[model samples]
Target: MSTAAEIADHKSSVRERVWTELRKVAVADSRFHFDFGEFIADFEGGEEAVHRLIDHSFYRDAELIFITPDNCLDRLRLRALQDGKVVLMTTYSIKRGFWLLDPAKIAPDHYLYASTLDGMERVGQHLTLAEIQATLPNVDYMVTGTGAINHEGVRFGKGHGFFDSEWGMLYQIGRISVATPCAAVVHDCQVLVEKLTPDVYDTVVDIIFTPTRTIEVHNPHKPTCGIIWDRLDQHMFDTIPPLQELKAMGL
Candidate 1:
């Protein structure tokens, strides 16, 4: 078994290699300059990948979807709204907690704008953890953008635990479950052939959609433990309001 340090080091190396290759191909988002922190969004075939996801059965069947705030997923968010699917997403880094985007409430003209992080605040309603538990229905599906991922379903996310925390909070509130199908959308270059070790808190994906293909895992690792508090420090607890709120409410 690989030690924690070894696992982290391997992930770092993979991230660096993938990020470098992505830049070489000019797939990296230009807005962020050279350093594509937390992986590059708007990569080559990104729109095509989103289109593929929209065509998938899971996406078609889902009424409510939890998508991350990664810039690459902006198109997915927009499509979800245009399709009238309820979107539950976190602010960048979950710094501001969860926002619920209801297509019915947003104007058709704003669909394009509302899909963005900045635009979400304008059209989406912010919800507290308690409010989320009281009102939101079970999330039908979940999708996120990744720094790098392997065929085995292991994911690395800009060294931040935002996605895991988001999953943990939702799982703790019974908003999502073990049966919820999770997926990752990325560029073909982001998919690694080498083995990647998953930490206990890592959330493995059931499906991977790239611009060119869809790869499904035989048996993805799903972490049942919600919110590994021991692994979180005071800084995280203090910075992420949702975490503090969840802990305070004893959720």
Candidate 2:
């Protein structure tokens, strides 16, 4: 089967599994009655645990990378900056809403912003989520979150595919290099023991950071460039003029 087919199958399978799990959990825990704050707190106390995890991980020198709009991990970017580490984060948009968390205080030079295809320039280099969304540009590394993309009976992402698309863009631009260390911050629940069937455009994280552990994927896979224009329908790609531009830049 083609890589695209494999990816699609994986996503479908994971979605089913995740929905099943979510439903089960919801049925068991009434507190998760669609309350975002309660859900985040009950799952892990959100930022508090995340802060502890960062301290336990000793991120002073590490290039701190995080998934956008994830309030939990995004807070750690601030701690990383306070400790004088390079932090890169993803943002949704500058005009749409306020950042769930912002890292502008640290001011690192290596911000990598993911640009919207519409030419919404990502704001900062070594940019956080909004930083990437506001300022369309290039950078060195990509931070992919665990469960961001899944294939064939596998599940990924809480519900968003921003990480996968961003990684795809970096790969298309030939920005992801051997030295580029891509990492992800995920909760323990997000990790799966089964081997995930990966597909083209699906980027595997080089490092996975959980509250208790920092994992490294020994052999990493890069994403496929040139967005299969017809196959692109994910809500995350809406208004992504930069996506096509990024793809064309690859060829």
Candidate 3:
């Protein structure tokens, strides 16, 4: 096994390499298939499979759903609409991290909805854009609990830091308190044992959901080091206007 510092260095390099691969693959796939959607639909029950993945967390009782940024599978979350089982899922927000997409339009008055940073809004029990905007640092709605979480060690899309940036901003602003449970769903093929060098700003998830099973992490939160004002990157701070305002207010 490599030392902690060495593992971090290796993992950082792996992250970069993986991002390059995903970009190239995504681009090539897009070019050859102008109607990739139609092509995917041709597969026996491919559409249904997509729906299954998106609704997985909801079926597991996830109140908040966090979807990936890839446009290819955007419509998968619409299948979870069962009356009384409303769930909210986040999409790319014009401002930052993610915004909730309506869980009902696809199913009718079947689900509830909410919004986030950007102009991103959706159907179902809508939380006024203003309310999400006013989320305070110490609010209970923003808090999460600590526990063993898993990422399955799968790298996200090209690792542009959007996910990390969004989580970090929420954490800094006190939106997602220290206790909120977070996890990533992935195929078992995505798990990695490599060392991860998490910076002070990195927000780790509490669990990893695989197609077959769920892996629990024991302790998820990291120790707090001093804040690095200069270290705040564009992706992290720019998406959150409130974060900027808070900083100006003396962050």
Candidate 4:
């Protein structure tokens, strides 16, 4: 069995390898440099992948979705709004908490602009954890962009725990459950054949959608514990307001 340190080291090596490959073929993001801080690169055929996700029954059936603010997911967010699906998205690192984007409230002309991070703040309603618990419906599906993922469903992103924290917080608040399916959208090169181990708090996705195909993991491991408070550091508590809010609320 690999120790935690060994697994982390392996994951790091995998990320370096994948990121290098991604830059070689990634579509340029005008707002960010490809090598920018933990940016999930938009890959070749990425728009096609989003279209594939839109066609999936999980996405088609979902009335509400919790999507991360990864660069690769901008199109998905836009499509969700155009389809009249409610979108719950967090700010960069969840520093500013969550934003709820209701299609009905947005002007049809702004759907394209509303999908971008800057546009979301202008058009989407911001929500606190308490507000989310009191108002929003349970999330029907979850989608995120990943740095690297394997056939077994294990994934990590640019060494940041943002997605894990998002998942943990939502799970704690009863917005999502073990039965709620999650999907990871990535470039084909980001999918690994080598086995990757997951930490206790790491999220395992039920499905992996690449530009070329969708691969489902049989009986994927999903974390039941919401937030592992003890593992969090003072930096996280200081940087992310939602964490502080949750802590103060004794959640």
Candidate 5:
């Protein structure tokens, strides 16, 4: 068995290669809007693959869902709004923090726009960590975009760790229990047949949805504990709203 450091190194190597190939496509693709790193959405047919994710049974049964603010997921969010599901979205880069989106709270005709980040800012109510603690309901399902994932449940998401942090916050606040299933929407090529182990505090996905099919991870592993503050720097607390709120709360 490889050591933790070795596993991490291997994971990084895989991400680098995969991202390089995807980035080449992203730069050449005319519709690509990515300015940062190689995002999964930049790949051909990336956002279009969300159609299969919306039709998954997990998504259909979820009443309250938490999803990323990635533009690639806009269609899924629009469908979620039309389905009358409560959607939760985070600010750009998870910096300003979370917002609660209710279709009932929005105009009937604006449901489509509400799914976009600009529309989310226009209408969604920003929730502080304390506010979320006070009034947030149990999340039935969680969804996010993944750059890559394997059958072992390990995932990589632009190497920023926002998705894991979001999951950690929900888990720590008691909004999402251990049983709450988390899914990552990805293109079929992003699913790896090889194994990639999760690093400590990394949130593993329970399901992977592709345009072709759903891949179930039978042994999904989530964070054993809540946020690993030791892994974070003080600068992070100053930047991320949730961390700042946690500090203000004397946590």
Candidate 6:
């Protein structure tokens, strides 16, 4: 077995490679740009990536989906909306709120507009974290975009750590269980060959659907108890409404 340091080194090297790949994609494509250290403005091949998700059981069978608001995955959300799937979107990285799109509440023909970031306001209802929890069923699947990932299922977001926090909160509240399937969609180059180590609270994707491939990560390490509060800075509690609420509850 490789040492932790070795695993980390491999990840660091691969991260750099992936970053270069994304940087190139951003430059060559009309749709993308580098956002801070991560590319988030847009990507040229997003529509193609969305089709990979659509081809999977995770997307085809899920009635309720938890999705990130990354523009790269906007079409995934749009497709979900068009199929009449209920989508639960984190409010700008899960700091502010949660938005729910119940197909019954939206007009079918206008799905694309409702899927956009701005349209989410008109198409979905804003709810407090608690309100969202109360009405939600076990999320059938979760779709996210990652800065880097490995075939072993280890992955990292854009350093904000919001996606794991959201998953942790849901597990803490009993909405997402061990069996819940999570998928990450990215460009083909984002899939790294070396194993990436995860923090105790970092949730790994069960499957990775890239524009060019589908990889099943038989992840062996699973963090059952969610959220490592100490991993968060105090500013998180102050600025993130749901974290503030969680802190107040003394949980």
Count of clashes in candidate 4:
0
Error of 1 at 64 (Å): 0.5
Candidate 6: which pairs clash?
none
Candidate 4 residue lDDT tens string, 138-240: 9999999988899999997978788889888888888999989899999998899997778888889999898899899999887888778888867888999
Badly placed stretches (over 4 Å) of model 2 are 1-10, 19-42, 45-67, 85-88, 93-141, 146-155, 158-160, 224-230, 234-238, 244-251
**TM-score ranking, high to low:** 4, 1, 5, 6, 2, 3
lDDT per residue for candidate 5 within 94-155, as digits (tens), equals 78789988998998789887888778888888888888888878899998877778877788
What lDDT is reached at residue 74 by model 4?
Answer: 92
* Cα TM-score per model: 0.95, 0.58, 0.55, 0.96, 0.88, 0.87
The C-alpha lDDT values of all candidates are 0.87, 0.45, 0.41, 0.87, 0.77, 0.75
Write model 3 residue lDDT over 37-130, tens digit each, in one string.
2111112233443444444443455444444333433333343333222333334432432344444443454232222212234333333223
Regions more than 4 Å wrong, model 4: 30-32
What's the CA RMSD of model 6 in angstroms? 3.1
The C-alpha stretches of model 5 lying farther than 4 A from their native spots are 1-8, 24-43, 46-48
* TM-score of predicted structure 3: 0.55
Clashes of each: 0, 32, 15, 0, 0, 0
Compared with the true structure, model 6 gives a TM-score of: 0.87
Displacement of the residue 83 alpha carbon in candidate 6, Å: 0.8
Top TM-score hit: 4
Q: By the lDDT metric, which is better: model 2 or model 3?
A: 2
lDDT score for residue 23 of model 3: 36
* lDDT comparing candidate 5 with the true structure: 0.77
Give the C-alpha miss distance for residue 55 in model 3, angstroms: 9.1
* Lowest-sum lDDT 10-residue window in model 5: 27-36
- Evaluate model 1: give its TM-score: 0.95
Clashes of 3: 15
